[model samples]
Target: MNNKLSLKNINVKYGESLALKSINLDIYKGEFVVLLGSSGAGKSTLLRTINQLNPLTSGELDFFDLGKIRNKKDLQNLRKKTGMIFQQHQLIERNTVFQNVLTGRLGFHSLLRSILPLPKFDQELALDCIDRVNLLDKALVKVKELSGGQQQRVGIARALAQNPSLILADEPIASLDPKTSHQVLSMLKDICKKDNISALTSLHQVDFAKEYGDRIIGLSHGKIVFNGKSDQLSDEILKNIYSSSTITEETNFTSNEVVMV
Candidate 1:
């Protein structure tokens, strides 16, 4: 199968520290892949690397049909083709849910168009995305008025409004309760399946990843320790991924990640 995003020997460094080491990954259309690892294992770096939010130290990157992104237009096109969901809701607390969702379309708008009011069709698209996340009831309400889970739903809707073919989510549910986390992740996976959008999500909960992902990629010490189907994950494999054992350190790290590659 042709991949939507391909990375070859990808490496990322934060100052002198290596965040990602010699990573090779390929994601097919509509696959929900989970990334698993303790904090500092480079899950965040991997996700950021996909959208060029984190520059590669050295590597080849490609988006299907778009080829290697070597120019500004290519990079801009990449951004427009991919969506992002942050760990926190990252919504403008004062903005209404619908308004926040509209921000997702700014990449496609001219500067003047962005500053001016959005067109009627764009407004309708934002409303549809909001409805996709079951947030239509809160469309006119300020983001601050919603619960934590609701705010995260708004974030998802914002990404949907971008109409992206790929989504990069960095531990998007790290702050929610167990029930809420499951609900949010389920909604995200369902949307991806329905839209045939490839999703690369970093998550902390192993069980949740198993339930939602078509495949799982586990990292340790900034290197891939395991990459296979979710059902293929064994405790021994997780042990290898989490590494030579640092319990307290792992406790401080983030959530699970699943991807279909």
Candidate 2:
């Protein structure tokens, strides 16, 4: 597989507190990489930093095709090719499903162009994305009218509309029930595989990670505890990754902390 991203000695800090420390990792094209950790494990920070949402305190990120993300133009270009799926879905409640998904293409347009009606190709892509997530029937319905699962599926459709080479999902199923979480995750995994897009998803459920991840990365107190294939995640490793030390002192030590290698 091609190397989609490379993080070399990555570090991120919020004020004086360190969030991610000395992180070194690489994600390959078409791989579904699952991140497992507690609430303050910096999973969200890591995902955000990839798109330059969170500025790195010190590190070198080599994104595929774009090389190093060094300037404003490179950052903009990186974001244009990267899609983000949030835990809350982040859709405009008053907007229709189609409108919500169509916004994903905004990254590809100029400010003036975004204010205008999207091109026909973008409209068609939005419809295709909606269909892929089985929400074509709900496309015209207001976002507020959809169920939580349906709304999350719309988030998936919006990300799909980006035609992104990579998708970053931060706790995508956090607010979902068990059954709905499975449905959403299964759909996401299938889509990534079918479309050959790389994905980095943070999930709290260890079982779900093992089930859906091509590879699993476990974080603890701003450090990587484990990086291995799903089946290689032994019981002992899980214990180490979710050790009590991470929750008590480390959790309160700083609001953000975690890393990968």
* Segments in model 1 whose C-alpha atoms lie over 4 Å from true places: 1-3, 244-261
RMSD versus native structure for model 2:
5.1
For model 2, state the Cα shift of residue 231 in Å.
1.6
In terms of lDDT, model 2 sits at: 0.88
Model 2 residue 233 CA deviation (Å) reads 1.4
Q: Deviation in angstroms for 151 in model 2?
A: 0.5
Taking the tens digit of each residue's C-alpha lDDT, what string does model 1 give over 191-234? Answer: 99999999999987888888888999999988989999988887
How many backbone clashes can be found in candidate 2?
1
Q: Candidate 1, TM-score vs. the true structure?
A: 0.92
Candidate lDDT scores, in order, read: 0.87, 0.88
